[model samples]
Target: SQQGEEDPQALSIQEGENATMNCSYKTSINNLQWYRQNSGRGLVHLILIRSNEREKHSGRLRVTLDTSKKSSSLLITASRAADTASYFCATVVNTIQGAQKLVFGQGTRLTINP
Candidate 1:
């Protein structure tokens, strides 16, 4: 499958702690993005890293991409209870049809306790 795999199916941490998530893909990709989904809701884009970028940071979030290793990682610092959500990694694949689509990983469920 073209979809990527995210490590640590679940995590539980106290507020103010940090959460780190990793992803690995099998095929070449144009870009990789991370999203967060609250329970019973849709996903919200968090960050996007191009194949040419090695690392990026936004607010309390950090994302790293290693195309050579077909892997990526996301780090959230000083997480709050409100940060509880399912985090996903999505790979952008260019198809022969001249279109692109996102193949998402199963995701990592994060729970932050107050």
Candidate 2:
């Protein structure tokens, strides 16, 4: 499958600490988007990095993409308890019919302890 799989299915860290997660995929993609979902909530888009881009940042979040390795990583600096959520990496692939499909990973559950 072209879906990306995040490493360390679950992570725990103290508030104010940094949290990092990694994801790996099997196929080529146009872009990769990161989403965060609070427990029992809808997903919130975090960031997106195009195949030509190596890294991107938004507020306290940093994302790096390595197309050569078909992998990506997300870093959350100075995490807070409210940041506890499930993070997913979705890859956008172009189909032969000229449609873009978004494939999401299983997700990495992050817990920030107070």
Candidate 3:
């Protein structure tokens, strides 16, 4: 079962503004990852934060994970029209089979208007 659910089903922002999206999960996770998908394209890995990590950043993207609350948030600074896309949060869990499973959130659709 999917464990993550992103808040704000949709978001619209003007170019150069900041965009934030949140995700909540129900179970313990080994790590969490964020992904972006453009229209009709594959998901692009954004960043991954391990359970031991509290925050991570890459370029304009900043991610913060709060395991105590089972939630995470992604912030995009200086948003651009090209940043418009669907963002998803995925959780990695270890199964009894000794393998890791990745479950994704519903997603947040962000629209960056120029």
Candidate 4:
């Protein structure tokens, strides 16, 4: 399956703490994208790192890619209740249709304890 596997199906953290999530994939992909969904809302693209990129950072988010291990990690520093959401790592797979599609994993539901 193209869907990547994200661990820590659920996470609970206090404000000002850090949250870390991991994702592992089985196949070769063009890129991996991290998206956040807030309580029944549509997903917001957090970041996307191509297979050739080793690491990327955006605001409080830090992402590291290890192609050798076929895995990636996302770290959220200085977390808050507003950061509570479901994070999904979607893999962009190249298909015969000449279109790259994103396959979402089950996701990790992160809750910030106030």
Candidate 5:
């Protein structure tokens, strides 16, 4: 499993604050995406940046990638209590089956105190 792991198994934040997470991978990959899960449940795609790109931003989300270091970072600004959720980094790669899959990490738990 050529997967990556995010640092800080858990995080705590206050409403209207910000949160950041880091991910480090093992091998080369085609693309990496970040996802968010609520209450350890369903995952929703948050952002995706490919190998050819360096940084991308959407609304309150900002993502940066460093292919040389095989790592990435995500920053969320002005978080709300509802923002409390687990964030995961997924990698897409070619397989012997000729299709790609999203492999997940343990995730970083973000808690927002109201």
Candidate 6:
């Protein structure tokens, strides 16, 4: 079962504009992370926000977590054509044996047109 779901299934924007993606999850998690994947390539880690953290930033990327709402958002400022890709939100789910694994959202596809 998928733990996370992203909104705005698809997004299109002009280069230099900003792109925002939202995610909501069903279960309690140790941390939430965002990843970006270019077509035909593996996902690249963007940022990780722990359950205790409300917000975090790295470069032009910003992430926010709301444990009470069981939601999170990712903001990319001044997006470029190179940034065109699919973005996903993932949650760390703990198992019975004290192990954890990532469950990813459906993902948001962002397109940047020049």
lDDT (CA) for every model shown? 0.94, 0.94, 0.96, 0.92, 0.89, 0.95
Candidate closer to the true structure by lDDT (higher is better), 2 or 4: 2
Model 1 residue 94 CA deviation (Å) reads 1.8
Clashing pairs in 1: none
Q: 78, model 1: CA deviation in Å?
A: 0.2
Ranking of all candidate structures by their lDDT, best first: 3, 6, 2, 1, 4, 5
Q: Between candidates 4 and 5, name the one with more favorable lDDT.
A: 4
lDDT of 4 by residue, 1-114 (tens): 646999989999999999999999988877899999999799999999999999999999999999899999999999989999999999987879998778888899999999
Model 6 TM-score is 0.96
Estimate, for each residue in 27-110, the C-alpha lDDT of model 5 and write its tens digit.
787888999999857889999999999999999999999999999999999998888989999998667999888877779999
Models ranked on TM-score? 6, 3, 1, 4, 2, 5
Which regions of candidate 4 deviate over 4 angstroms?
none
Which tens-of-lDDT digit does each residue in 1-114 have in candidate 2? 647899889999999999999999989888999999999999999999999999999999999999999999999999999999999999987779998888989999999999
- Give the lowest summed-lDDT range of ten residues in model 2: 1-10
RMSD of 1: 1.0
Model 4 scores a C-alpha lDDT of 0.92
TM-scores of all candidate predictions against the true structure: 0.95, 0.95, 0.95, 0.95, 0.93, 0.96
For candidate 5, the C-alpha RMSD (Å) to the true structure equals 1.3
lDDT of 3 by residue, 1-114 (tens): 569999899999999999999999999888999999999999999999999999999999999999999999999999999999999999987889999888999999999999
Kindly list the per-residue Cα lDDT of model 1 for residues 1-114, writing each as its tens digit.
647999888999999999999999989888899999999999999999999999999999999999899999999999998899999999988879999889999999999999
Specify the poorest-scoring 10-residue window by lDDT in model 4: 1-10
Query: Distance from true position, residue 64, model 2, in Å?
Result: 0.4
RMSD each, Å: 1.0, 1.1, 1.0, 1.0, 1.3, 0.9
